[model samples]
Each structure stands twice: as structure tokens, then as C-alpha cells.
Target: MIMTKPRIAIAGASGFIGIYAIEELSKNFRIRALCRNLPTTNSLNSDVQWFSCDLFNLKEAEIAFQDCDYILYLIHSMTKGSRLTQSTFDDLDLIIADNVRRSALKNNIKHIIYLGGIIPEINYGISRHLKSRNEVEIVLTCSGIPLTCIRAGIIIGSGGSSFQIVYRLVKTLKIMTTPKWTKSLSQPVDVNDVIQFIKLCVGNKEVYNKVIDIHGTELISYNELIIKIATLMKLKRTLITLPFFNLGLSKLWLYIITGIDYYTISPLIDSLKYDLKANHSLYFNNYIPNPISLNDSLQRAIENEEKNEIKPRRKTFEENKVRTVQRLNLPMGWDSIRLGKEYINWLPKVFFTIIRSKVNNNIVRFTFLKINLLTFEFSDDRSSTDRQLFYIKGGLLVIKKDYPPARFEFRISPHEQSAIAAIHDYYPSLPWPIYRIFQASFHKMVMYLFNKHLIKIQNKKV
Candidate 1:
């Protein structure tokens, strides 16, 4: 008999951890995402159902989880309490958990998975931050349903709070005066490992009704972590430990030097006051054996930042004009002269041109196999190949009659040594998901055609 995929509901789906968890878990299970605001993402999977919801509204929460078999909760408020009123973070956590349990009970949900902080080594010395996490776990357990609480220490991954703090401290100062918190031992786990655990524990019986403690193999102090990070980045640094430094003073100094909001840093530092290692290592039946090392995890974080640094942010506009551009070097730079400008331009050798304010209505026809298979034209086609450089601007980019509707911009710029092109397509008319499949190839083809035209022009061929 063929088995049906389970339905998993992800609460707080807009968080960084929730976002990644959805990507990982969606492969084998149907996913339902619940959040107050729609996530700002263009690469969302087609199979997932995203619902905008306010969890505090019991009716709304129950409706959202009506069909889900598993619930994965990954949300924690940093500011804590009621917005205008001063309520504690722990209190707010319990309130949210009660709402989730009520909804789960109404929907007959089977499992609840939560990612929480590991308990502090000292019995009663738990920081306010960790206490909130522990209290949340207790709230979930009160529902009388099977719960899997994967407790972990500072997660070392891209965009994680702990990693971001380390990044700011290392990037800002070469020489620093730190407090005793820097000496506390910590067992940082990789974000990838967290994802691995979530994926494995979906319907596994061994992890049910258990509070599992997870962490990496290495046990290092904050001072050591900073030193290793600096060395990996190839920087010189000096650290001075000052025992007299006050917690309030440390938070103020961090806010001033790093420009990180004090609200987020306060509770984090409080948690760092004690040793933050797991009570004991976890061994699940379906666990991903042998997580990656600390060095590898740090390297991954750096790589993620480097990629985000160069990605382009799309702009909002009245007309839905979407575009992707790239720069590349062709093997031959002198081909523009032979087939660069004017006179048929051979295969086609035109460089960049300034786009006119408005588009022109002109029709150009191309015949194929004794029949007019394709007929199209650009609004403006003033060709140029001066000094092995030219561009195509304000042209009719008709791909078959009725296409592009009307009003589109096409620009091409070619220099003595390089070329650039920006192709814009109407959002509603273009096949976005289909186009994404060939985005890389499209970039390569643009470059290929630019260079090939020069060869055809020099050979005196059409």
C-alpha cells in the first residue's frame, strides 16, 4: 500500500529558523505555514500553503490547524511582555503556548516540535532568557499530547542571534576589554544540525514525550570562540578580561560600539553569565550521525553573508517590470568592429544605448521556412558599432504578435572590452517559475549571442 504524506504546520513561519525548517521538511510532508504577515520571499515552494493568521485569536488558530497532524513552533519574543504594558517575556510565552495547545486539542493534532535553549549548568541560576524557554516547554507539555523539545545551546549558523553578536564584536574591534561572561564554557550547535533533527523526528516514536539536549562535539569558551573567528578571518586581535565590568555597563557599551539594539542584547548577555552546555548528549533513533565541526559551521556563516552582500534587491514600481542582469567577459573583444554597427551588423553587433523616455510603435517581421513564423520590432533601433561598442535601446521586443502587450524597455551597452544588457519583462505575462529554471542559462545565452554576432559580422555572413 502506498503511504500518504503527513501534514505539518509551522507556527512563526517568518522567522529565520522557521524559514529554513519549512524548506527542509517540505520535501516529504505537506506544509501549512501560519503567520501574521506574509513572508517576503520569492523562492517559496509551490507545494506549501501559506496562511496569514493571528495566533492569539483562538478561532483563527483552530481553523489554521484543522488539518495538520504535526505542529512545529519556532517563535520567541525578544522584547518580552505586552506592548504598552510591562509583562515579562516568560508570561507572554505561556500565553502563546496556551493558545497553541487549545487549537491543537480542537484540531486533534498529534505531535508538537519545539526548538528551545539548553538548560543552564547551575540548578537554580538560570538566566531570565533561558527561563522563558524552559517555561514555554512546560506549557506545551501540559496539553497531554506527545511533545518533542529539542533543547540546544547557541546555534552557530547564518543569521542566528548568537552568530550575529560574535560577528559584530569581531568586525568592530581589534583590541577589546571584556567581562567574566567571556570565560563561560559554551557548547554551540550548528544550524544544519538543528534542521537535521527536525527532519528526522517528524513521526518517530523514540523522540516523542522527551526533552532532548543537542550540541556539537567541541566545548569551548566565548574567549576561544572569538579568537578562532579572528584567526580564521586573518586578523590580529587582543582581548583584555576585566572582572570589574558591570552587566549594565557592558550592555551600554555594546549598544554604543556595535549599534545593536540594547533590547535584543540584554537577555542574550544574561544567558551567557553561566556555563551554557547541554546536560547530556542526545541519541535519537533517527538522528543524523556526526554533525559538522565548529570550524566548518563558522565557515558556512561567512559564505552565506558573502552571497547576500552581492544579491540585488528588487524595487517596487507601478508597472510590474522584473529584471535580472549580469556581467561577463567574452573571449574576443575586437569583434565589434567587424560586425559592430550599422549595415546589417552581420549576426548582430550592437552596444548599449540610452533608453528613450517613451516606447515607439513599430512592427518588424522575420520569415522562417517560407512562412512568417515570427513578426516583431523594437520601439527604437538606432544601431551603432563605434570603436567596437554599441547598444540596443528602446526597441520593439516582440516574440510573436500580441506578446509583451506593449510598453517595454530593452537596453544593450557594449564597451571596448565588455558588454552589458538589461532585459525587462512584464510580471504577469512572464513565466516566472519556468524562467527561474533557466535563469542561469539565459544569462549565458545573452553573452553567447553578443559574441557570436561579431564572428558572423566579420565573416560577412547573415
Candidate 2:
């Protein structure tokens, strides 16, 4: 009798760590690579099966994780999924994490492994980026299934975003004007070492349900790291530090030099202000005594780039689809069911003359000037006290509806004192440009007002 290897399902399998992970983990585990789009390039292992999954959709996540014994969650929601995204990265990350948790629970998966950022010891004034990462970690931890969260610092490798930022800065500028944030320290880990750590943690009973922080042997300042990179590159550069320089100027400077977008760079720059060395140091020290050096990692990354072997992760967006997420103050003792009802009642009251909302036979209608603008049917089967789901059945603003239709979700945040209201997979009747300007803007304004209303309700109760 032959024993089959444990099937490992990898989300974000086309990314930097995912690609490397597939190449490495395929040797030991039966690999099931889950991604939004199937990669155009060949996989290192021909036996690795690919499953196309849009992780934002819970049904898709459940289907993708089926038959897999362990899950390697490598997803990050920094890039846009639709043509226009009216949501913050944190909200998107939370939703995706919740979906993964639910999917894993329903499937009865054995273990989940999440790779996240190194959270600062002093939690005060944490950047949105790190906070988002921490929130994701929290969501996964509550899954009841065993979880191992490896919080790593700036990952050093070719094609990796963090490394590229450094590489580009060193290569591009001869005379660089730096901010005080450059003095902040970080323990940078090599991509290969990160992969090794993941390999060690897989099927290891000791590491399950633990948060491990791993990093390189040395903790160096950003300025020192940059100087080292410059030395390795054999380039002569002058650096002038501005102690009072603001973050806005730093963002613009890096954006101009690296040519990376503000969305990607903003969080990274914000995170650089705090020193983020690992706290749980000896967890994996016994297994891999000698980690890769920063100089060597930089050298290898440079070589890979010179050889044209590295490819950055690519994002593919759908046309005309919309996803909007807003975090609102949750009225104390209120669940999603009541929150959804409150939203319905509040909408008409807020815009009394122009808008009218009513529910008949569990079907909700929002009308403008007595014309049905939107229709939603309550989904009792898909809803719970913690989460309420409403399907967008038909509306004047809807041009075409996909199978299962789009949805509106009012969900209670597990840990935070807030509720999340989101619209998913919505396609408008208006032209893309027109919808983006008018309908999108209007929806955001309404949500903003609703948030104010919630705060007022809480204040009155207090």
C-alpha cells in the first residue's frame, strides 16, 4: 500500500513567495496552486495542479480548498481587483481573511499558514499597512483550525517589492536626500530563508497555532542597508539626511525614483518609521542555525536580476465590476442583522424627499422619485447574526447580473468595535466613466453620512 502525500493548497501562488514555495514544497507535498488567473508561464513542477479561485468569493475559496490537507495562505490585497476600487486595503484584507477562515472551517482543513508583516512591539501609532496585516492575522487565528503565522520583516529578493524599492533607489540616485525615517531599523530576511522557514513549519506539530517572528541575524538601519547595497553594487553615492522632512515628501521622492505607484509605496514608507525586529527569535533558530546574510542576499538578488530570471507578480482586473467596503462604528450590542435593518431605515430618513426604501415579502427596494433604483432580496440561507447577506436581484442601475447575482454584506468585525458594509461584484448600467464619477461618488457620500449617524447614535446612548 502506498501512502499519498498531504495535498497543500496555496493561495496567491503566482506571487514571489508563492512561486518559490510551489517550486520547493512540490517535492514533499502534492501541490494545488490557487490563483485568480492561471499563470501564463510554466510551473517548476508539472504535477502541481492549478485551481483558479477569486478569494474574495467565499464559495470559490471553499471549492479551491477542497481535498487539501493544509493551506498556504499567501494573499495580500494591495492591488485593485475591479476597474474601480472604493475600499481600503485593510477592509479588503479582512474580508478575504474571513472568507478563508469560513472556507477552511467548512472543509475541516488540518492547518493554515499565513505570512504577514512584522508588527512593532509598541502597537501605538501603527501604520494602516501593518495594522491591516495584524488584522488578517487575527482573523485567521480565530478559525479554530490550527494556524501558524510567520511575521517577517522586509523580504530581500529579486522581483520582491521591498527589495526592488531598495535596489531601485540605490541604482537610480547619485545624490539622495533622505528623511529621518531612514534611521529606523529592520531585520531583513532573504526570500530563500523565508521559504526554508515555511518548509520547516509545514506538518510540524510544535509550530501549529503559534505566531513566530523570524528575521536575519543582523538588525540594520535603513540608511545602513542602503549604504551596504550601494557598496555591493560598486556605486559611489552621497546621502543627505533631513531630520525634519515630512512623510509626504519622502513618498513623492521614492515614487519619482522607483516609478512604483503610491498605493504600493505608501504603506511601505509608513512602516519604515518604526523599528521592526523580530521578537520571537529562537523558534526556528535551532532548525536553521545559519541564516542567509544581508550582503549575500543582496548579491544573489542582483545576480538574478542581471540574469533576467525574476518576474514580479501581475494583477488582473475585471471590467465594470465594483467592490466598495466601509468600516462603520458598530452600535453596542448590535449584530449584522440589526445593522442591516438600521441601514435600510436610515437611508430613507437621511434623504427623505428624494429616496424611499421599503421591504415587502423579504425583498428590499430603494426608489428615487418613485422609480425603483435598486432591488435586494434578503438571503436568509446565507445570513447569520454575525453576517447578513443581501443579493442584488434587479435594479435600474444594473445592466447585467452574473449568476448568483451581486451582493450587499453587513458584517460585524470579529475583534474590532466596528461593522463592515460592503458591495461586491456589482456591475452598473451606466458607462464606466459615468458610473465612477456619479454613482460611485454618491454611494461613498451616503456611507460617510451613515457612519456619522452611527457615531451620533452611540454618543446619545452613552
lDDT of each: 0.64, 0.88
Q: What lDDT score is found at residue 417 in candidate 1?
A: 38
Mind giving the per-residue lDDT tens digits that candidate 1 earns over 185-205? 888888888888888888777
How far does residue 411 in candidate 2 sit from its true spot (Å)?
1.2
C-alpha lDDT of candidate 1 relative to the true structure? 0.64
Q: Over 4 Å off in model 2, which ranges?
A: 41-46, 309-317, 402-405
Query: TM-score of the candidate numbered 1?
Result: 0.64
Worst 10 residues of 2 by lDDT: 308-317
Model 1 spans > 4 angstroms off: 1-3, 41-44, 80-85, 284-286, 310-462
lDDT of 2 at 77: 87
TM-score of each: 0.64, 0.94
Look at candidate 2 and give me any clashing residue pairs.
none
lDDT of 2 by residue, 1-462 (tens): 988889999989988899899988998999999988897875656659988888888778889999989999988887788878899999999999999999999999999999999999998999999999989989988888899999998998888888888888888899888899999999999999999989888878899888888898789998888899999989988889999788888988887788766678888888899999899867768667899998899899988875884443344568888999999999898899889999999998889658999799779999999899999989898899999998998878987654364889898887778989999888899998899889999999999999999999999889
